[model samples]
Target: GRKRTFLACVTWFSVLMVLCAAAPGPEFFAVVRFLAGIGLGGVMPLAAAFTTEFAPRDRAAVAYVIMQSGYPVGGVAASLLAKWIIPEFSWHWMYLIAALPLITVLPAAWRWLPESAEEQSVAASREERRDAARAGLRAIFAPGIRTTTVMFWVMSFCSLLFVYGANTWLPTLMQDDGRGFSSSLNFLLCFNLGAIVGGIAAGWAADRWGSKIVVTASFLVGALAVLAFSGADGTALLLVLAAVAGYGAVATQTLINGWVTRSYPAQARTTGVGWSLGIGRIGGIVGPSVTGWIVSATSGGTAAFLLFAAVGVVGALVAGVVRHAAR
Candidate 1:
């Protein structure tokens, strides 16, 4: 169910991305972008849900982490492309290039992606299907789940606050600290690169140790990384600290994803992860704006980094309290 729906959503997403590229004016572009974002929104959570269903129990965390790492891997790829496309072509051309996935990847996914056994079970009974649809909403917070449900939402929120905050502003913060524009953007490159590497490592660790501790440590270490960056001086030192911060900041999401996917039953997994993702997007939207306002008000990089560090602290504490059920 998630896979077929995913295909449908990505098909629409590609169409919208093309529409965005060809839009004649700001109003049209904005509308297209909104619709495109709606399509884009479904891809990840559903992918996570689908991945959870197929992943081997013993290697669950690793499977999810490998999938999750693609987020930053994609960001890194786009950043590299931007190096060439933004100058040689226009922004619309970038959108057109993004639309390439529809042609190249969609066909391959259609051919290769398996429908989960869970999807078949739902289809087997019309009466059961209705019950499942109803239960999906109720099950995430059903008995024995309410506390963890709320905890997961909070963890997702706090994790994304710093994740998106760093994504949107780290370069700007670097620029404010006197690095050149290119150099500042390079920090973003470094950050995402570390995210790719760190996500895999975190996933492997989570599989071995459990997500609660792993995620908590990620938040604490990332916070410290940001603090260390505030004191960093040389270009090499700054990038190194940025990489460390990226490692922790981005890996936090990886751990949560694995936990949510692992913890929720298939009947309710989509709803669980979907709601968690929706909550995190709220924080993601607020994060950049909040950081921007704080930076403007304080007029200092130290204040901004301190604010993000504090978010990490909050995330760490929240993560520490979320216990893994024996399931």
Candidate 2:
């Protein structure tokens, strides 16, 4: 229900953008963008929950990897489509073209996806629903869970800070470091390619060993990669480090989500995952702001890289505590 509501709102807002953009005014475009952002904010967590719920027990990690890869794959497709269309059609047509996939997918989603079984079960029992809701709130503060919750929160903060900050500003950083446009785009492609590989590999490792070890190693290695990337002066080295960081950075969240799903029972899994991501969104906001400030205050690329690398280290340490708590 909530997810559907979010999608409806986004669809409406997307239409508004088209109409507003047609008018050609900054304020209108700004308002439309804000609306679009609200829609985006609601979709991601819901999608994560949906993925976990639908995924089979044995292949949960693989499911997450495949589901998360959609973002990069869609991005690549959109870029190609835009390149082909933008020369012949107006920019508005590009937006319209993007809407085609949503039209096809939304109908399939409406027909196929099941309501969350946990939610449905809760609804069937009024007393149980109340008790469960109370317990859900208390679980985050319970003796066994309090530390785990805090650890995950800290991990989320650092992980998102690095992920969003690096992705948002890295291209500009590359250009500042004297790389050409083609080289920077190549770096992005390499980075996303690594992400696809990393997601699958991390999932397999987590399922085989444990989410803890996979997450911890990912953060530590990711931190090192980011630090090395800070001094990358050559195109080859920069692309290599970007790919490594992408592998580590992108897979960290998937592993963390898997951990969350396994740590809590099905009844509260959605709440746990939702709350963690909600908290992490704050980090997502802070990352870009902090990076922008660092760029203004110092050398843009290097300072931002160092800040993100430091964040990765903090995430690695916190993830250890989370692993302990889970055990």
Candidate 3:
């Protein structure tokens, strides 16, 4: 019910943004962006909760990987569309172009997505005359869950740090190193392409092995890839490193989400997933800001990459802790 209300509000705000774009000013644009961000923020956790509810018992990891992979895929498409249309049309047209997908998908989602069975079951259990009270949010803080929760928070922080920081600055970093704008953009393309491949592969691998090992290995590889990306001088090397970094950096998100799902019971699953992502948004905000600040201070991307590499190392250690705790 709350999700539905939030979605309605976001839709209204989006409509208002479109209607007001014609008479736009700085204030208007700011309002629009703020509204859009609210809308985007609500969608992710809702989708994650929905995915967890509907996914098969054994295929939750694959479901999350596929869903999360859509983020980068949408980004890639948006980039391509903006490049093609912004020159001929205007920036407003870009918004219009993006809205088309929403129009199509909204109806489909409404029709197809199932209500969360966990939510229904919880409500029913609460009303049952002889039912024993099940574990609640407090269970998430129990010793068994506390460690995994902390580890996931750390992994989420580092994964998003690399995902956002690298994607935001990688092109500019390449261009600063004497590469052309086209080359820089191509690197971004290759990076997201690698993300798609890596996400699927990581899901399959995690299902076979365990999410802990996959996450740790990904961070270790990502740390090296980011370092290599910082020093990549040739197009070939840059592309190769971008692919590696994308695989390690972006795909780790899938593992983290899967691990979190397994750690909590259905009753607390939404809260757990929401809290992890909410805390990780802090890292998301910090990653780009800190990277930008370091680049400004040092006048080089090398220092920024080194900082991110350190973050990845921390993530690797956190993954190890999570594995130990799970045992």
Instruction: Provide the TM-score for each candidate, comma-separated.
Output: 0.95, 0.85, 0.87
Least accurate 10 contiguous residues by lDDT in model 3: 125-134
Residue-wise lDDT of candidate 1 within 191-232, one digit each (tens)?
989888888988888888888888899999889999988787
Among these predictions, the greatest TM-score belongs to 1
How much is 104 displaced in model 2, in angstroms?
3.4
Clashing pairs in 3: none
Give one digit per residue, the lDDT tens place, for model 3 in 1-327: 324644564465456546445636878777776766666666666677678777776777777888889877876786676556767787777666555534766666566756666666666543541231235456567776777777788889888888889888988888888887666777788788788888888888877787888889888988999887776777888888888888877888767876776667766666677678777777888888888999999999999889878988999988977644222
Candidate structures ordered by lDDT, highest first? 1, 3, 2
In lDDT terms, how accurate is model 1? 0.84
* Residue pairs that clash (backbone atoms under 3 angstroms), model 1: none
On residues 72-191, what C-alpha lDDT tens digit does candidate 2 reach at each position? 565446545555575678566665664553576566667776777666665557687677767766766677787787788777778878777877777677777777655555666767
Q: lDDT score, residue 324, model 3?
A: 40
The root-mean-square deviation over C-alpha atoms between each candidate and the true structure, in angstroms, is: 1.6, 3.2, 3.5
Candidate 3: Cα lDDT at 177? 84
